[model samples]
Target: MDFQNSLAFAKELDANDPLARYRDEFLYPQVNGKDVIYFTGNSLGLQPKRTKKYVDDVMKDWHELAVEGHFYAEKPWWDYHERLATDLAKVVGAKEKEISVMNTLTVNLHLLMVSFYRPEGKRIKILCEEKAFPSDQYMLQSQARFHGLDPNEVLVEVKKRKGEHFWRTEDILDKINEVGEELALVLMGGVNYYNGQVLDMKTITKAGKEVGAFVGWDLAHGVGNIALELHDWDVDFAAWCSYKYMNSGPGNASGIYVHEHYLGKKDIPRFEGWWGTKKETRFLMQPEFDPIETADAWQLSNPPILSIAPYLASLELFDEVGMEALIDKQKRIVAYLEFILGEIDKQVESTFEIITPKDRGCQLSVFLHGEGRSLFDYLMKNGVITDWREPNVIRLAPAPFYCSYTDMYNFGQILKEGILNK
Candidate 1:
């Protein structure tokens, strides 16, 4: 689709957009009595208007039904998380049984690692991309230390070439082969958080399996933003937070996917809790853990109904439009955004560069050359919400669910003004 860097063209696109009505579903922050152009959904998603009603339903159950609400509520608290499985599975492209909405992302990562990251004998090293999200880096370092191995020796981070901003797929595949027998686990983000580069998870997974290593993905930025086929990709496991692109509230319960082959394996080591036990016999208080034969087995505790409620509300939206429609809009809007920025670059004497890859999600990380946070502050003051990474990058994520093409045009105008006025 040819894109024009004009408000008329943007409004025309918005008028034709199939997903345009979704913008009203969310509540946007206001600045000077107008809605801010929110492009920071990559960091924290805007709250859906329905989220309050959903959480209120849970609160009503608690107020009237009290303890009996566990079984008697309209949507029973006891199995609240179960209601999300089918819809969540569609968003991430996994079987309903393989997906479970439970703990937060990193917590689920550690739980999955307990079962999948089985480092022994000569295969002790765990491979990940360099500059992974800080939490993941810390988790990998500590997990290696927990296994009585030096993180420096056992944690292998694949680095980009000196001039490259993102990791090349071949480099990752070659590293998997280079490590070969010594690599126990291959864990990386489905999308690089910094540059918004969506990795080729299928190829990476195949490479890891070919080399006898367990492979998993941290889909924190990929789940609702990009089209994923985790089960078909043969990814051993995967985890993602709902708050970012999924537009669930902040720090909401995360979803997980465990391949069916591992579901019934009782011999697999896991930090089991009572919630992991089969629901039928949960009341019997059995001493031995009878794990549910699905991703449900990984759940450590009964989920917080309030937290799950917001996610359920968000998932309903996902189920309505589906990933295919959302992805189409994603491609179009991102292309328009790129086109607008390119036009801005031509008009302004600014030196910023877009570091994000073309094969990416909603986010485009702009490297502000010979400038600093002051320009970012300028965008913020003018109600263009974006995120700033360390050094010189400002990330903008125009989410398809709520962000319109006009928002992209407005962002370009504001960014151009911000650059020119400087």
Candidate 2:
């Protein structure tokens, strides 16, 4: 993990990395004449090299099979949605019947809220972290308004007690009990986007369940990037986009999880369409909605095959190297990153802090205590492609699939120079 001493030391660590072969799987960025050290995986993951084939397979089917592609093409478009369910389930730690690949993240969130957030007279409040993704906040607000309740009255955010960098487990559980019968759902990010802090999802879900509230998660930054056990965790539901850590290009399709126990509850309504109907009876052109039980019942339409193709391609790489192994590799690489960044922090005169939790996934958020934007721009000019969040944070992620220790070492050097020079 001692890759911070010099560029040579960093190169040596990269040489010994077991996951080094994965660096060649995706396209790398170039700034000026050299490859830029990209640390923005938490925002947008690099594209897999096999994406073209994945897209082209669908394209080829469209060209030759034309309308017949729905039933006749290779991997038949008719049942194509089901094909991804098994692997997608593996990605999120759910059973095949508990997962479905469809819809964007925000859309899925709203759909899920419609089915789960049925608040009674006074039991209308939702418990979430205050600084949640804006989409989540907006969805909660809109849902509360739609239910004829003011957001201020119904939405309850679990604030950090006093002034703490992160939320406490006891504080959240206490709030859950304080709200008790009033709480409708407990939803939060699996890992926060800005700070890269992996929240205790299993415990939170259990706490929510204990208080008779549904539980869900937004794993936009967590899926494929960290280890999850939604089935084992007994989570009620969850949604996540594939573009971030799943490495499925920009704005890829997302997936959902529903615990298997819920499949038998026919009374629970869903925003449904033909695609979610049972495959055997779907094309029968029937009238009554005999909803296909299981997670696929949540689907509202046919998947955007073009958008989903790259996800399939990206998933293949993960299937080859299972999530456990990937997570193991991430720990090693991120530990290396933390060791280097920590040492660089000591040499600099300017105040710099790693706001991200030490045990987080590969991503780390650096707080420029004094100079923020100017230093960020300086790093960009020096061939480092990390992104700057508003205020004073630069989120760096040395993704396991494509990043090397040398890449992080180079980034630390440029980042240090950027701070010192500024």
TM-scores for all candidates: the values are 0.99, 0.97
Cα lDDT of model 1 by residue, 73-107, tens digit: 99998888999999988888889999998889999
Worst 10 residues of 1 by lDDT: 344-353
Local distance difference test values of all predictions, in order:
0.92, 0.85
Decoy 2 TM-score against native: 0.97
Could you tally the backbone clashes for each prediction?
Answer: 0, 0
Shift of residue 252 alpha carbon in model 1, Å: 0.9
lDDT of 1 at 270: 88
Clashing pairs in 1: none
lDDT per residue (tens digit) for residues 1-422 in model 2: 33446778878877877778887888878888887787888888898899999889999999999989998988787678787887888888999999988889999988888788898877789999968999999999999999899999998888875755667778888889999998999988888887888888888899999989999999998898988999999998999998988888787788889898777466786776887778789879898676787788888888888888888888889899889888887998788888877778888977777877664887888777878588888888878888888898888888888888787777778878887777
Q: Model 2: which ten-residue window has the lowest total lDDT? A: 1-10
Off by over 4 Å in 1: none
How accurate locally is residue 271 in candidate 1, as Cα lDDT from 0 to 100?
A: 88
